[model samples]
Every structure is written in structure tokens, then in C-alpha cells.
Target: MTPSRVIGYVRLSRESADSTSIVRQRQIIQSTADSRGWDLVDVVEDIDVSASKRRLDRPGLSRVRAMIAGEEVEAVLVWKLDRLARSVVDFGTLLDEGINVVSCTEPLDTTSAMGRAMAEVLQVFAVLEARTIGDRLRSSIAYRVGQGDRWRGGPTPYGYRSVRHESGDGKTLEIDPSEAAYIRQAAEIVLAGGSLYSAMQAIREAGSKPRRAEAWSISSLRVVLTGDSALGRQSRHGVPIRDEAGVLVAPWEPILTVEESERLRAILAPRPLTETRRKASRLLSGLLVCETCGSRLRVNSRRTAGAQVESYGCRANGDGRVCERPASVNADQVETFLVDEFLAVVGALPVVERREVIRDVAGIAEVEEAIRHVTDSMREPGADLGALVAQLGTLTESRDALASRPAEPTIEVVESGETYAERWARSGVDERRAVLESVLTGPVPVKAIGRGYRRMDAERVAAPWAWLDEAAADFVDPYWTD
Candidate 1:
């Protein structure tokens, strides 16, 4: 008789600490198939997948099912029955589907009444064992957290890696030197009053790779800078775990101190959106205004003789309003004139950096809400009282910490030791735009000038400084005339 065609299935759960390896399972299944004179067509596996997962959640299992449904295989062989399905419901579903499942270790003759009964009993025991293991694991994790141990089970925070503890009992997080240096530089950039976007650019230029993504995302960078893990504080689900005395439990080395982390968080906190649309990438985006219709001029570019030439014009605004006598100016000419006039007017002024020391009270209400949730859960049946009590202690500590902070903001201004001109020379476009906003009350209005003016007509521009100078001249002229 021709050997029966069969396909072998194997699975290894992520939490199965003592489960058989995929290689061992494959060896057993292959040996069993050889002994039974079966033609083993293929061996499909789901590694690091839970056996309790539904069929749709397991790609390898789904493939096996599809093959069986197509009648391409006579029997599906496995190293053991539990590796195929951990729950009796799943096992019974497979039986009801008339799947000829053959376990290498636990052979079941499902045609016999006694065989079906034994299979059901074995499946029941498998489910019970899975739940028991899950409970034990949860208890172990909770005990570890309570004892001031950081959980390194999942992905370690950026700039850190899990290493075996000195006692060889479990894993502990240690700073990866290369990645930590990048983090330190990033923190310095942020603390020095630089935007997160600037820090991201610096990291990318230095060839620093993030933990997962090809480059750092704004959200990921914020987490790296402001996360409790950066300050060596243990936390779960973004809430810091506190000890019995309401102090945060930190057991590993830190990339930043508590003060530095707080300051970074303050600087990076979300602010209300403003109507300002001038990006740092553009030099004169929000500065120039059309003299005719008072609409902000937009940058327009054209390819001229194998080169791109940019100009600012107020042809039409977004509201469908077009200037009857639209004004246009060369970008380079206007930029140069503005920079020169700006520096000649206020270049000697000193640059002062203003820093705001803000106390974060945004998450206080959130902590209180979480405390209420945990309290409500305690009244429910089968609630883990020990775990819930521990959680409450941490939440209370967080609330106390937030409540102790002063509500008023403290402002500090220090000299940057650079003149306006000196800073302008070294600053980016966005920085220059900020300087213009500080000195000017509103957009600089440009008079309607025809195209092809090689030099910037100083009379055609009505900058704030020019207006002030002209007013002073008029005041002195009236006195001289009388």
C-alpha cells in the first residue's frame, strides 16, 4: 500500500519557558512518520506564538487548515496534542471538522469511544495547566516589581539592553554605551532651548539608529527624553512604580537625572496651536505683506534658464481674494535688503535667552482618575487584592508628587553672549524669523513695484524701523520749519 501523505504541525508559545524546542518537535514528528511509513510532505510551525490563540491568529495553523480543507493531506501529525490546541473547545472543534490529527507523543484512536474520552480528558488538563502557568507568571512579575526590580521581559527602552544580573537570577537593564551617548547629546540639545526637531536632525546626522525604526519619530523621541525609564525609575504602562514610602523604585542606571528629565519634559510639553505658519525652513514666509490688499505674500518659484528662481507675490489669498494691483518682489533681493536693514538697525543689541521653568500639573487629574478606577476594581469579585493594593500605593504616590509642585511658573533670562548680528549669522532660517517677529509689530508691507528692479528700493519697503525713522524726521522737520 502507498504510504499516507501527512503534514506535521508544531507550535511554541512565547510564555512556554519549559516547552519543547521546534527542532526537537520536528525530530520527534519526523521519526514518528518514518516509523509509521507515512510520507511527511511538510512541517509547518508557529514559533513564539501562543497555543491558546485562535486559528486566525496563527499563520502556520491557518496554512495547515487550508491544506487539510483542500484534501491534500490524509492526516496532520504533531509532536503532541497540546502543541496543536491548548483548550478543549479548540480540540473538539478540530474533531468535529473530521480532521485526522495524529500526535506523536499522545496517540489517540478517536474512532473508539474510550479514545475520544481520553482525548477530551487530556485537553481539559492542557487548558488547566496553561491557566496555572499564566497565574504563576503574573505573580512572579508582580513580586519582581514590588522588590524594586525592572521588568526586562519586553522591549527595553531605547539606549538600554537587558543583561543577566550579577547574581545570574534574572535580567537587568544596562545602558548601551553607544546609544546612551546619543541620548545624552539629545538631552543637552533640548535643555539648551533647541527644538525636538533640531535634536532629531542632530541624531540622524550622527548616524544614530533608533531601537526599531530606521530613524527617530517625533513621538518616539519625546518618549526617550521624557519617559520614566530614562531617569532610572521603574514604571508599568507609563505610571511610575513607587515603594512603600511613596518614593519611585529605581534599580538600574539612568541616562538622565530627575531634574534634567523634568526640564526636558517641560520644554517638550504640548502647547496650543498658533496661527503662525512661518516654518523655520523658510526665511521670509510670514514676514512680507502686499501693500495693495494687505494679504500675506506667498513664495512662488519658476525654472528660469536651467535654474530655479523664487519670488514672493500676493496674487491671491486662500479666501479667493486677489489683489487688484498684485505686488511681486525678488526673494533674494528682499531677503538681502531685510537682513542688511535689520542688522544695521538693531545688530548691536544683545541676545538674551528666556527660559520658562514650568511645573507639570497636567497629569494630576489623570492619576486621580486612575486611583478611582483601581478602587472600583477592588470591589469586584476575584480582584487580585494584593496587586490592586500595590497599584493604589503607586498611584497615590504619583498624585502626591504632582500635588506638591508649585502652580506658578518661574522665568529665567540669561545673556547668550552674542549680538543680534552675530546670532543671525549663525542661526537657521527659523531662528532669524523669530528675531524678525520680536522686533516687528506686524508684517512688513511692500509697495507695488513693477518687476525687473535689480536693487531693492528702500522707499518701497515700509518696515517698522523705517516707519519710526520717518516719524522722527517729520517731528524734527515741523520744529525746524516753525
Candidate 2:
């Protein structure tokens, strides 16, 4: 028989730093090929890609598939069966394609029934191990979260620099003053009613750049305004949550002050009616229920002179008594109600207190350096993996110990609502709106109340500036406010 043409395939997940190093995998493949007197046809590698247990996404696997389809290779070599595939379906497909697989490190060969059984068993173990790894990672993140530590592994948000704190015992992460100043300024701009575009321009004019050369955008400004973490609050799976007593809490250093944060929230709160109309126009235009024939309502833009008005009405208006509410109500009136109701709820919040809670949480960053130091030690070369794991265990224990420590409670109160009002006064329109939306309830709901009026429900609205409904009732015009 001609010398078996052996092709090597390797794959690694992005989350792992050293799963499939090209040099290492290539060395193993070359060594195995040399020992077996096999001709190495090619080496294919997939870096930073996941091998789904049910589906393989490895580029190397794809190349192997192509080679098999083209009848170019006799056998495929892999570091292990798990590296080749985790799914039985994929394994079956590979077998059906008439390409044999050999594991250099394991006694696995697809040619024999016994070897195939072994491959199946190995695949089961691989899937189990992948799930175990995922669980462990989630547990690690949850543990860090419980300790009020930032779990998302990436650079700090813009307008803030991750600083290392070193002391006699260990190190931690803190906020860099220079970058934080920019964060504070951004918050101020939002609270002042500045537009997101203008605010971005202002940031650029002030020589402000995101941590990774990212361009400033309205969405980015909205993220900053709504990010409780910047104010030293913890965001659990993207939703901001409060402490035991419904108070904002942080897992790391705060980039903005409580006052500034509250002000920003007030500025970004949503206008329910206007938001509803906009969304309805886009998604539910002809799909809305008529409440009469139960038929879908067709959206209509009633125009007077040069201005256009929008509303939803029955699709069959001339269907006689079958249609219940055939007349159109002013969309503007409904939008106004929503805006007022949303603002009212948001303005009722104690923004200053919430900000202080965030501040206290940020103080925990003083311990982040210690955590990082330990984390780094565990990742060192030739390091005892077990010892590093033990160190992580110890760090977790220490964190719990610190959290259990008791402290005196002293309330720091702001003078009045005027505090935020003054801040808002200083903010630009766009910035103010961004701040408002960040703290407002997700979206306002509008229901038909009476002719030319609608009931707006914003019971879920939770912004520091919700109290502003009373102060700015006339400013409820969504389209003209900006």
C-alpha cells in the first residue's frame, strides 16, 4: 500500500489562552508522523474557535472535510478524539465519508468496531468536560460578582482607566483620576440636556478617546449614561440591580459622582407616548388590534397643511356596526401622556442616595489589585496548577471574610431636588435626554382612555429624575423638546 497520507487537524476555543498552540500541536503531529513512517500531507489548524458538542465549527475540520470530499487523504491525525469531534453525528459523517481518524495520544482508530466504541466513549467524556469547564467558569464569575468584583474580562469602559493598587499584602484595581474626570464631564453633559451627537463632539474636542480608539456614537453615550457600573453599581447580566434595601451598589470603582449620575438619569428618561407611537409606527402599524372587529388596525398619517400626524385606525372603517372604535385619536396626545407619566415616576427617586451607594461600591476596587495579583500567579509558567487553584479558593474565602465585616452606617443626604435641577441646568439638551433614558423604565405603555386622550402607565419606571413630571409637565412634547 502507498504510504498513508496523514493530515493533522487541531482546534481551540477563544476563551482558552493555550488550547491549541500551533507550534506544540505541529510538533506532536510531526513526531507521531515520524514514528509511524507516515507521509504528512498537510497540517490544518483552527484557532480561537469552539467545537460545539453537537456541531463542529473548526476550520481544520472543514479542511479535513474538503480533503475527504476530494479523496485527497487516506487518514486524518489528531491530538485526540475530542480534538477531532465531540458529536456522534459528526463522527458518523466523517466515517461515512471514508476517511479514517487516528488519535496520536489515544488508542482511537475509526477502522475497527472496538476503536469506534472507544471513540464514542471518549467523545462522551469530552462533552462532559466541556460542560464542566463552562460550569466552572460561570461559578468563578458568580463568585467574583458576589464579592462585588468586575467579572467581564476586558478593558475598563471609556472615560476611565484601570489602575493597579499595591500594598503590603496584595494588589487591587482602582480608577485613574485623569480618565475619571472625562467620565464625570460626560455625565455632566448628559444631565445638561445636550444631544448625544453634540456630547460626542464635545468629548472629542476635549481630547477624549475611548479605551480602544473606538469612535464616539449616540449609542456609546447612551451606554455610558445608563451604565450603573460607572457610578459604582453592579450590572447583573446587563440589568442593573440594587442592594438588599433597593439601593444601587457597585462591584468596582465608580467613574462618576452620585450627583452627576442621578442628573444623567433624569436627562435620559424616556417619553412613553412618543416612544410608543414611534415603535408602533415601525413594528405594529397594521398589526394593532382594533378592539371592535378584532381586526388589525392600519396605521394612517393624517396631515394638516405641511405637518403630518400619525394614528392607528380600523382597517375596515366602512364595515358598518362591525367596527367599534373607528375614529382616530390624536397620536400626539397619547405620546404626551406617556412622556409625562414616565417622567413623574423617574423624578420621584432619591437619585443622590443611589449615587452614594454606587460610590461606596466603587471603594471596593481597593481590593481588586489583590485579586489580580493572585489571578496572575495562578497563570504563571511551570506553576503548580493545583496550587493556583488553591490560591483562588483562598482568595474567595478572603473576599467572603471582608464582606462579612461590619461597619457603622452614616447617611449622607443631599439638600433637595434642586441639586439635580441645577446639574440639569448646566447640561446640554442631548446629554440630558441620554441621561433620562438610561434611568427610565424600559418603555412606557399607552392605553386608550377617552377621546383625544390616553392613559399612560409607567409604573415600572425607575429613574432618579422621574420626579421631573411635576416640574416640566409642559416639556412633555417628545418631537419638539430636543
Q: Runs in model 2 with CA error above 4 Å?
A: 1-3, 15-20, 87-99, 149-155, 158-173, 251-253, 257-482
How big is the RMSD of model 1? 9.0
Q: Estimate the TM-score for candidate 2.
A: 0.51
Winning model by lDDT: 1
Highest TM-score among the candidates is held by which one? 1
TM-score of each: 0.63, 0.51
What tens digits encode model 2's per-residue C-alpha lDDT throughout 227-326? 6667766566776554432234565666776656656666766657656542423222322344445565555787788899786555565655465445
* Cα lDDT listed for each candidate: 0.77, 0.59
Task: Encode model 1's per-residue lDDT on 1-482: one tens digit a residue.
Answer: 12389899988876366766888999999999999898999999988887765643689988888888898987788888888898888888887876767778885645456767888888898889989998998887776676565453667888888887777667778888889999998898777656798888889899998878998877889889988878676776567775543345668788887667778888898775874654434588878888899988889889999999998888665568967777788888888888898788667877666667676585575467567777887999999899889988988998999999888888766676767777676456766776676666578898886556565766777777533654445321100000
lDDT minimum window of 10 residues, candidate 1: 473-482
- Where is model 1 more than 4 Å wrong at Cα? 1-5, 13-24, 39-41, 54-56, 149-152, 161-178, 188-194, 244-331, 340-430, 436-452, 457-482
